[model samples]
Target: MKRLSLITIIILLPVIICAYTYTVKQDGTGDFTTIYDAFTCYDVQQNGGIIYVFPGVYENVPLFQVTPNSVNIQIIGTNKTTCIIDADYAFYGFEIYNVNSNLTIKNFTVQDASIAGFRINSGSYGNTIIENNNITNCGFQANASVQKSALICHGNALIKGNTFIDNYNNWDYWAHEEFSLGGAIYIDYHDASVTDGLIEITNNDFIGNFARDCGAIFATSNQVISISGNYFEGNGLLESTINNNVPQYCVIARFEDCNIVDFNSNICYNNESYEVQMGPSHEQQGLVFKDCTVAQIRNNTINQNLDLSATEGIKGIMINATNDEGAYNIINNIVFYNWDGINCMNDDYGSLNIDYNDIHNNPPAGGNNNYVNVTQGEHDILYYPDLDPLTFQPIWNSSTKSRCIDAGVPNLFDDDNTPSDIGAVCAIKHRIDVVDLPSPSVDNGLKWLSFPSLDDVYSTSSYDPDKAGDLLFDILFPFEDPELEYVKHENNYFVRQWQGNWQGTSNIFSKTNGYIFQMNEAATLEISGFKVSDNTHIKLDGNSYENWIGYWLEETQTLSDAFGDEWNTGNIYSIQHQDWSAYYSEGTWKYKTS
Candidate 1:
């Protein structure tokens, strides 16, 4: 007992009462009187620590202009309902500029500002965590003469689990008014040039906002974003009067030099326009949806509540790939629709795969008039379990007896072998297919026939894992040719084929990382129980070769480290193109830098 007491005292000794901690109350008591007074009392020059705002209504004052490395300002509330930041006075409320990191503003009700409720002008790219805050009734002008955003961001921002109600869209007469100007959360890359910044907006509710232009959570230039698990109701341009410029969509991506927009596990319904839109303009001139891209638009229950007179359900056109059609621009989806569905240009040479969809009621399909018009240099092909007579609407309501049921090429769709089902499904406890590719050797350069995820079975990892972790992060090279049997963790197996010559079809490889493994080689290599994805950062081993391994990443491939150098997959290394740049010999993994 004595020893325990001494140890407890030692641990407690470092705990100071924290005398500098400034506390503010609404009734004008403690360290400061009013909330704004507390904000002002703490001189950015002297007091530098926690600034706690006790429960009360703080109306109409621009709280604090955070100075550099001044202090880690934390605006804490007794509870979510008690704390509030009212902009009943200032034109723009809570403008944060030129500050260090570690700025956390949580559980505050901030509303009624002339411009933006919360504006992040500029700050060090560190940690800005805004959580559980209710910011609403803020306004933004939609006219060509003025510019505003509800939660305007100029640098890297992270906004999560907050409710933004009735924000943006203050203009009623401007021909083009955007309700969710930044789509609730907006971002523009540094200097509007693709310099690789991170913007994550997740699990938020955005209702009754209007932005006449781009995404509800819009971002421009070079930025990588993840807009996931968000609920957008009555979101988009409100075409109240007829000036002919209603808002377009729930989400939009435009003129993005190099970026990624991932929309996953989200429920979007009843918007004025298409749910999501991506383009380099209507003509689809300069869109490149490749390497830095892969939208897992699966398991999304997209119901249409469009005004009918205004927009359709969902339409995605010009999915970029403008630079290297086959290599840089690839759009794959397993969309399961209830109302209207998706439509896109057909470009086979562009390497787009659309499989296992519950596509109903699409006019001008099958017969002599296909839904898509194939331009001269486009490669548009549809792979499915068809009657092969090119029968359109063959599986309609009464007569359509789930023909695509179990009769799909799953291998081609989920190259990752995530779900064994043909279309996108919600059931998590489902089986998955095996991933199989070709072989390579000293004779041939290198080739991977395909992921072989088609057959009804559980298999192994597609790529071999290095000594450190799983094989290639994004794609796991297959182990066996075809395990035809349903092995639960079969796809978890992998192996790295040693130096060798290989050959096969172009589609036998992945467009993600620029390296090409031996596909369809005469010899056989077997590996099992190997894991990949965010784990093993495997690349063609040595430095005998430069940029040229056995293959190249697709054009849109923006991976900095092809071998998983960075700890995580998304932010670090990336693989681009699909061409062989190196060959193997002398008992090792060689490369061709030239």
Candidate 2:
């Protein structure tokens, strides 16, 4: 008997699992009308499934708990801002009970809940992803104490790209001394140090949340906790005015006893009380063993916390981790306009490395501005960052450049292939084309393509391969056929056929030219490059019969804005998406359906 090759064996070893997807529409056109009834179906609840909710205001939503044996579920909204699941201050958000199945909730406005927005109870082993949501006014208690707020998570969870606003812990008038867990998110106290207990909270926004203790996040985890790329503003600024004695201990995040804390690229602005504190928890009653954190806190920008009238705005970052094993490196950050800059004074573990930071404007009578409790570091500087007040990016329009332009450590570099800046602000790319693959033709897998993001100036010379996934889209053995043929229309139809493992001519690829993709299967094409433009100015081929034009405009625009003065004069175009067209005749453009 002949044995199979390793590649063929590996490909055949995988099992193909079929998944069911249900759509919930408010207009009674989809598979289900209500979000609750969609999950309650026997086929969706017993087996794994996906539910897509359409754009509408869904009212009076109850607490949706993950039942036993219900696994691998996803509830996604059509639009992030429009599709709303309004709880009406009556019920809690979605909950995951003691199940080892994965659950994902994305792109919804989960608003006005009485308890946690997305609660993951203990005994959950699978991953829970809560992404791209607007969780507002959830997680509230009437007269109770020790209440956990929005996005209360346990086990492996990823909370990313969510905006949380005004999710209070308790609404009691006289509970000023009440012990609050977390205002926006409480990692429901670590559950016994399992190896698979990991949680990552990244690229989220926390604004105007309230707790008696921590006003934003109070995370207690034994897993590797990574909180990065988050924006925190006005946390602890909104509080109950009836009894306002309790101070917001940590305004942004209070991480307690994590295994590894990689806190990077966060921006905290004007939040009340201490911003981003990491220390051992006081809940263990001074018998903590696995609490000394190995932290890498770098490239963060903490600015202008509280007005100091509350007297709780103490430190920008108060890192109290007595490192038992690994080191704590605090580098390349800008801590400005605070009561105190940093208080990483505790060196009982003797592994505190603090350098290359800009700590300036500490409110005149600020607290510890030292690196080691007594003396300042030699690498720390007091310089004006010259940042934009709104976006927090470095000011680049003026002749005088910002001091944080190229001030980071020499080994590190920014995402723009330049020397890294000091603060959390990074440059956003000018043009990026993230388009899904167009629908495949019924007859063949051939598709029409146009490079909307390719720069004509950059493509004239050599191109950067790393700018996109690949500049030439990997001409090295990508085609299914040994000799694959592709055509592009420039002055004339130029068709080229190349064999496998041979790089084709790169000059035929241009944004001005349209091509036919000889693809074997459908796949997403990612293209990002550096090109500053208001709108694409296309110089159409005058000699050619027709021109293929493509422009990357995010929003809808008038036809005149795109083609300029030539829009209505004598131009004719066909929209491939809608299969509609408008042909110019006798100085008039008339629409026609195919």
Candidate 3:
């Protein structure tokens, strides 16, 4: 045989060493049927490539393990909602241990694992991106001795646009044990070898998650971390039966030995425990820098986080720092409607600056003394900021507009104009446009709306044509019986009567403009061309409304104005669209729904 020339061998190598692309489809129509088959068949060690999974459920596979120094790979899905990797039998959905780098997992739903959805072990040190995935129902069957979470990141990672829901860890697998740590996400440094680790968690939704310590997220000993623009709702709290009494803090970032930690622009509401807890616990906060060198906590909206335990009530922000050299800045945030606002325990050495914040209405019974622990800056407002009921944005009024306008730091600017309002956004003036309403007409009336139950009931709003300031409205309906008695009041308003829970008649007053209605529960009412101003807010029972309509157009106009008396029960109605022309131009209001 004749020996091949150098030019002939070089040309053949280019065709042989090309990267491979594999498609894993559940329907046996692709290159591989299972994800494990794709990993085994592809030349991952030499030439790493993409494994695109089609839209279907892939179940009963191994832990989808990736070894150390493996080829850089991407496991992508056709759709985040449809493509599901259900590792219900395995300990974890994806166990990446000591991987080199450039591992990307995106756009899939990973659920029902015993330990965790994605477990990135300690030695994995690379640029990792975990985005647009739903990690749910994990960590429930984890071992008693292990600490588990839905997503555990021990490497430098960027986690964004993911939904973590209904993930729980067992309170105590053994009798009288303190075991579980995080429910949704846990970020920790395993050893000193992994230095300067950076993790950014942004724009994710954490809902209905549970654990012993932190329900949403727990971060410790990371060098640099930024958590921003995330929505955490209805998370935290141990089951009522568990006996563990440890202080369960939600969204904890205990950076006892770290540098540069920023928690900003996050919306944390309706959670079960403390909204945020940062810094050390035992030492004097002002004397020694316990955890973090520099910390910036700004522009976060924390509301309605109450203690799950009746015996132990919860507070809003708990910052315990002792570093004189480092600075802890809590500025431009809205800490409202909790048991307490900001409790800062700082030693003489630590520099704790609390300024330009709206801390009010916490523990409505307690006076101003329960608001702020530190001596706030001159611009900080203590009274109710009068946030919009629906959007939670600051309304254009005396209480909110007077003190918060132009109050933030010189560098930061509000959304509206030069004068920046406190909290997340600046005050923008506009009218209330009914963006959506429950469709099929029946699902609109007589529904139970509460935290974690009707939590997904959201109606969109915007500032538009009417220019009616910030519009807030209340929902009213009779319980048990559909028949309601109406009496016209003196000021062109009507007082409607209905049977109460205590075998007594309850009376509600209607507004003259035909939009606002008075009831026990404070709901974010949607009315076309309505403006929300001064009104008394009353907290009602969890199951309050029986026959709820969006708004009562004319109080004396009877059942027809209340979106019709006949409604189909047991069917869920979703909002289709709001007929703007019908309400604005014709004066006859009608909400079009499917």
Candidate 4:
């Protein structure tokens, strides 16, 4: 009988709890008509309950606020697309201030906000999760100084899987000449108040955003910014095209101080200046792009898909460490055909290894434009095609592939565990041709040879090394010097390096370093590569001896055999006579008439 009485009391507990619990709906089923109406009515619970928001456009006007200890406010949405909270002309779409731990906001779309999409300004000790939301056109008319991101907050936040497109500068549209650019997301660290902000912005797509300075994303502040596995494209807009007053300039990442900014496995294309532009000269941040000491920027593609400027200002990607010095590992990227592929201006003694990049067509004009330029004071080794160092041969001529292929340090191809290319793509030798060497040796050291293939001079028809992860096109560009003419050889011949003597066979071909060799006793060496006496030298036993018998010959025996004249009277070394001892080393040797 007592067990039945305890069961009866437990069944009545739900009846008592439902009588006091509140519900919010637009249809007027409860006391409140919208979700924000329950903020002041809901009390703190040990295990916080759910607040279901029905499908409708809830205009959050007159701005609701959540107090401290309002833990576990889970606003469950039926669907993100249908459940819209439009914050028109307001500073934030959803503002969370003074909330306790475990505040999850998900499965909702926040659009058309005046400032940030979702802002967390002064929250303390709360785990904020903002995921699976489509935030667009939020910061369309915000201030340039304060407008940083689509979904921005000051506390520790995890912003993942949310799409941020087109957070542009609308207020300063006429100031297009200034630097401002970012499309989807922007994270700034709060420094005035003493607090460290940590955020993880990953797995998001940023497309078609316009900021003259930082087109896709501009992150600055005294906070930790971690960016990985994201795609950025078409964020650079022409500031002049937008409006005369519009400020124009764009960059991917521009930040300063207090943490790590690691960019891994990302793709950035069609932007104006660079994928990631660091340093405080773009801004007045004290820490600048120096906060991230050990930056790991690897496995990315910074290609020039669409070029708007005729000059092609800075078509490829660049990394500039204007003030600080640390380990910057920039590996495995395919950068091609844009003024410069990879430009690193490190201001210290730290080493910069730019290995395994497909850098091509910088000047593209066949005269001067495409190529990597390194400023002085940077202790770095630049590996490019073979240069004569005197004549500067095979200057690429601004094509994707030229005869200057595989001319870099061969050992850096696959020796290290890092990526094998230099700028962005790795160049493979299509055909191997022997390089012209000053002298040949059995121990060629595997260094004096470069195989120039015809297939390496032209790019593959349909292959894009920047896309589809295939490097077939990178190996197909023809790498021949534009200034050279093609020639065909029929037979092999040797050139001798002698100037004068007696001769035998006319079989030796005349070449750059060729000369005549004496064949026998009455040999007459006829050197064809140089002029006779003044511009040439003739030596016996490898010494400049005085004419003892003939004119200018070190020995009269060599001159007497050529001119049949005595060493004393023959004008062999004369300007007009080839056997005159007076014009040779005069009075230096004894000559006798035969």
Best by TM-score: 2
lDDT of each: 0.44, 0.65, 0.59, 0.46
Per-residue lDDT of candidate 4, residues 308-336 (tens digit): 34344444444456545555655554444
**TM-score of each prediction:** 0.52, 0.62, 0.61, 0.52
Evaluated at residue 351, the lDDT of candidate 1 is 52
lDDT of 4 at 52: 61
What range of 10 consecutive residues in model 3 has the weakest lDDT sum?
A: 449-458
Native-vs-model 1 lDDT? 0.44
Q: Please give the lDDT score at residue 368 for candidate 3.
A: 46
What is the per-residue lDDT of model 3 for residues 381-480, given as tens digits with 9 covering 90 to 100?
7767666766666665422333444556656765533444566655564332232222223343222211111101112244221222212212224344
Model 1 scores worst on lDDT over the 10 consecutive residues at 482-491
For residues 273-309, what per-residue lDDT tens digits would candidate 2 score against the true structure?
Answer: 5333334321100001123457787898888774655
Off by over 4 Å in 1: 1-21, 34-48, 60-66, 123-126, 140-145, 172-180, 192-196, 240-258, 273-301, 305-340, 345-594
Top candidate when judged by lDDT against the true structure: 2
Q: Give stretches of model 4 more than 4 Å off.
A: 1-25, 29-33, 38-52, 61-73, 122-124, 142-149, 173-183, 190-197, 237-243, 246-248, 272-291, 313-315, 337-339, 345-353, 360-594
Comparing 2 and 3 on lDDT, the stronger one? 2
Model 4 scores worst on lDDT over the 10 consecutive residues at 481-490
Q: Provide backbone clash counts, one per model.
A: 79, 0, 16, 81
| Better by lDDT, candidate 4 or 2 | 2
Sort by lDDT, best first.
2, 3, 4, 1
In angstroms, how far off is 345's CA in candidate 3?
A: 3.9
Alpha carbon lDDT at 242, candidate 2: 55
